[model samples]
Target: MREAYLASGLTLSDLSVQVPLAKSKLSELLRGIGLYPRWEIVSRLAALLRLPHVPLYRLWRQAAFEAHKSREWVERSTDNTTALTTSPAAPPLDHRAFCELVEADYLLYAQTFLIDDTACHNAVGDTFDILWLTWNEALASPDTRSYAWTMLRRTIMSRTPHIDGRPHFTHAAFDTAALTHLTDEQARADHLTETIALFQVMGWLPPTQLDVTVLRILWRMPTERVSELMGVPPALVRSSQHHAEHFLKSALYPTDNEGRTP
Candidate 1:
């Protein structure tokens, strides 16, 4: 509880007010969940401690596997084919590609980390129409470009606990700071290329199979809509997003397991 409070910039009293459980009960709950008071609790802790309705999904997964002796049931149920007809059976991604994708995603996310709510909204609104047009056209084609387009769209549009309201770029400020040195056309092209490369690496698609045109379509998409298209559930999306962020952070700023920068 203490660590969670510290990491979230909230006090124990502040959390008590937000959460339904009494302070004592909450403390007990935290202890039962294997968290020491000194360990830094992240967004996961905040969600678990404050929101009565928000399930402790990670904990549940852990316990479920421990109890069941195998994750086969969960895996079977959550298999890609069970969810979306469009979900492809691509090979696992290579480490290099995964690292590159993680890096690009981190860069994109870094652009919006400091934006205020109003700015976020305005950016999303402005970017959505253009992205939608490009996405629709890309979807119409049935090649590797189409697959990349689908994957990118699904990744960005899927619902996540971190983002609320409509999944539109207007809601999130589009970060142009990274492109300040480039011409408008160059910036757009670069954005498309970087984002496409990121997705290709993450999705584990081969360079020969990657479609630059599809990436062009994704570049214009609103972040929220992209999340929706990804078909990831809202809560899971947030968790996955967190993992992706962590992966990027680790890559960009290499550190020991103790969290000290190398």
Candidate 2:
């Protein structure tokens, strides 16, 4: 989409005014950054680009299917796209029920890390869409919840921007800053400095420790649920959280050159 927009010689501002979607969302669409867009938005953009509607809709359908959107919902979103594709297999009721049950958990997990509502929602929706595609396999597994949780993590992690091969947490700086109720300028600055340091240290932790820290400390999910989602024993979850806290303390409060606490 970015390539198409570039080739068409239309500025982002032009596309923003022309398309029905918001400018920020349009930018995300063009960059392929956020949730897979609904067909109507894409179709209008394609029309503006003089791209063939049928071919674009086919591509969009495949993406939407992968993102876990229902065929019925996709069809309802745009008649033109619906006409271009054959009817898809309906998602099972069991899968639907599973999605309803875990969607909030998935959203909370994503938001606690991603920090952007759109990206968080997209990750959750994509997780379910992927689980729907693999429902039979998930059912065959001894623990369906575990299998689905793995799928959800994969979906979210892939979308999570990384720094030096670790999950990036610097994006959370804005939200972290917003949490402070400090009124003094110096105090607020002090709080933000520590918050950013903590977020950066979080990105440096080993993956398992990072996951445990986020679930147990930041999101405040119960240890049992964290254990299930991570496919780890509850004891291990507690241990990891303990180690993560230790690491954070060391990283954020280093000893001085003479071995004295700073």
Candidate 3:
């Protein structure tokens, strides 16, 4: 309701006048849903938002159904409604959780891609030149490169669904396998070196601080874990994360640069 009202450029007061319910009661209804305006208030708020009420209502109903289904899946082990509804190959992810994961993946990928691309574009030398040097120095033999590629392929494959109709949720398994395979000191050193080089090329880190802290935090930690690691309050972490995300997008797809908004 608030999102619709804001998008329509109308205040709650403006909406209250058009609705049948008293403003105070409308406010209470909205407050019940983490919004301040009641449904009666937003009854005409749809028009202000330039959206028909019927479609919006339908969308809201669908969202509510999905939320209810997700909760049901979490609470009742016997119920496999969601699993049965989705394709067998698709992981039995709770709808809300899967959406959140997908959103985070998109944001992280965009940030990393932008930072890397920009660094490569500004370099006086060939961008992959550093990657090649790092590979040569870190890898003991030609076989090492093949091994690394295999490790990478396995990790990617584990997260992805098989070509066959097998139903598997491979993320946890994939991480375990990757960590186990790359636990050797030499492999760890090589990975760290390559990661640092890539970050340097992306201007995400300086030579003095080769750890790529932000990327590590984003990749290795959950949002709540990131807050704990940063040692700030959760709210502050959220604010900082949002600002950092905006900065990354701006860096990658500048306003003056023609193309998508990112």
Candidate 4:
């Protein structure tokens, strides 16, 4: 919201007049220093910034949910759901082109993080809608692809269930055929232990290294494609992959340091 406000080149005083919100309260909203503003305020600000209200409303609802607002309260707050859902602001052509370019890879990334098919689709769809709402700010960023990818990652992480402050990998572990097909209870338990340990290690990796390892190793995409998707140079992608490999080896096999079992 702040980014879009900045990109709009509108002064607070002008926004005060336009949004009819007090300068102090508007500052709080922009800086995220106060309680979540009412949706009416957010919707008006989005309109003044030339942003569509649908996605912004969705974001507001998400924030409210995270703030522990009940589903009933959220539903009751919506006076006209049909109008918000059917808002007529179409995405720009460039935005559509960008979506076409990266849609497949976005789905793959979301699917890997969220094992549920329905959740994956919703994640990607919400991401695109968000990108649409903030397209101008995204274009102003250093790398739009990187900006969008970061948004996608955050969306998936927010939806992913966690255990003990870490992402729960039990569902992801079952995807491995070797672990899933084990009929013997003892063998199945052993494979699950190993698989979950690997996933835990992967989860602990820095974001860049984790993404590089997933795209390059798990998805088997070429280096050039990974570079394009990540909005980083090919050299950086290769370097991240190398670092991820070393980190995984060290993390998963600390007992065998320097190829010698301790």
Candidate 5:
């Protein structure tokens, strides 16, 4: 809302003329320090700004209901009957809880992409950027956790989807399998070196293969979860990951006719 106001380049005085509010009151409203406007006022303002009404109506309901009533609840069952009960109010989540959720998500997220500490931190930071810039207002609603999760997921998805070794992507896109098999015990001992090489090799893989490997090995996410996130079937996720592993093993550790690493 603030963003739209800013983009319109409308000052408080300018907004006052469009709606029945004073500059001071408008300032307070913008800062979240005043009473919510009546539905009529909300409707007028929404029209002036050309914003959608459904969600704005929801905001009005939350404020109006909370002020006049106690906890509000809705009930449902698998039988499709509407149940009624006074459910507890949603607890407000502070910044601490938000950070904790992000951290927990990252424990799974950090596993999906092979990123340095700085890059990973930047990715997490990016989520907060979205939170404050876009979704912060929505946090006041009952589904704060879901809002936070969605913003973070969007941030992660926005990042470079593939390992970008780019100019540094050595022509080593060729067969290095004979040089080091991913399955070799000796190669396993040099994980750091192998990991670096693997990252480069991954840069060459198609998006599907790379994404599957990331969700499975790096994120350690279950097939169903990966399927949900990627919008693919579980079988496809497994198949892609399997083929990716085969290519990686064959590419990383090729063998001579003797069936030994040359």
Candidate 6:
């Protein structure tokens, strides 16, 4: 469709006169970045492109069938895991059920590491689109779940902007700034508060370290998996994680002037 549209020298906007579809919407279908389109829209697009409708419809059906099979594979693969591997593609389902089953997991994870609601949604949205388009590949290999998971991580790392690490808050700084209370209850509250604050502050870290820490350290993904996602060596993934851990420890749990827990 894309090739035909280009070859015809008619922009999607120009073709919109002949078909009742939005140019951008057509692009989504042509790119396969979105869910299935209505038959009328598909037929219109094929006709406008001077392509035979039946063959194009058959192609759509084949992709949809593969997408459905992959959805079943994902559901089965996810049923056995603690954290849902973030693959966005699934066969169309009841809207409420879709959110409960698929969208919630990624949203929760995104909220945990991102700075705000916009960042959270934006962080997960691109991955969602990519997965929605290509997640069927998950069913092809023996390491089905792992392959799906690696794709998810790579999606995140690829889309997010990099942050260069500079000196930032460490745990020791916070400890000195706030005197520890005498009671155990106060101590626990302070601990919980600081731990959460530390997580939010991750948004300010180098994006690479943030990716490394979230994938390699917090998620406990294998170094090789993180490496593949970040497009770096496994050793560097480990090293980035190591440095990220050290930075967080210093920022979230500062020691006293005497080198003791305050």
**Scored by CA lDDT, what does every candidate get?**
0.38, 0.75, 0.39, 0.81, 0.57, 0.55
lDDT of 2: 0.75
Candidate topping lDDT: 4
Clashes counted in candidate 6 amount to 9
Q: Judged by lDDT relative to the true structure, which candidate is superior, 2 or 4? A: 4
Tens-place lDDT per residue, model 2, 98-208, is: 788778777877875776798788778767766664566699998897788788778778877887787886667656525556778887777778777888899888878
Clashes of each: 21, 1, 2, 0, 9, 9
Positional deviation of 38 in candidate 2, in angstroms?
16
Tell me which of candidates 1 and 5 scores higher on TM-score.
5
In model 4, pairs of residues that clash are none
Model 1 TM-score, 2 decimals: 0.22
- Indicate the worst ten consecutive residues by lDDT in candidate 6: 80-89
Give each prediction's root-mean-square deviation over alpha carbons: 21.3, 11.9, 22.0, 3.7, 15.2, 13.3
Off by over 4 Å in 2: 1-90, 256-259
The TM-scores, one per candidate, come to: 0.22, 0.63, 0.25, 0.78, 0.40, 0.41
- lDDT per residue, candidate 1, 72-167, as tens digits? 654543343211122222312342243243334322432232245443332332223222323333345454233443444333343211333322
Point out the higher-scoring one by TM-score: 3 or 5: 5
Q: How accurate is candidate 4 locally (lDDT)?
A: 0.81
* lDDT for 36 (candidate 3): 31
Candidate with the larger TM-score of 1 and 6: 6
Which of 4 and 6 is the better model by TM-score? Answer: 4
RMSD of 1: 21.3
Ranking by lDDT: 4, 2, 5, 6, 3, 1
lDDT winner between 1 and 6, please give it. Answer: 6
User: What lDDT is reached at residue 17 by model 4?
Assistant: 86
Candidate 3 lDDT at 172 equals: 24
Residues 1-262 of candidate 4 have per-residue lDDT tens digits of 8987988899899889866579999999999988766676776777777677766777788778879988887776675333323345677889999999999988887766797887888788889888988787789999998899888888888888776666655567777758767899999988889877888888877788888887887678899999998889999999999999888889899877777885
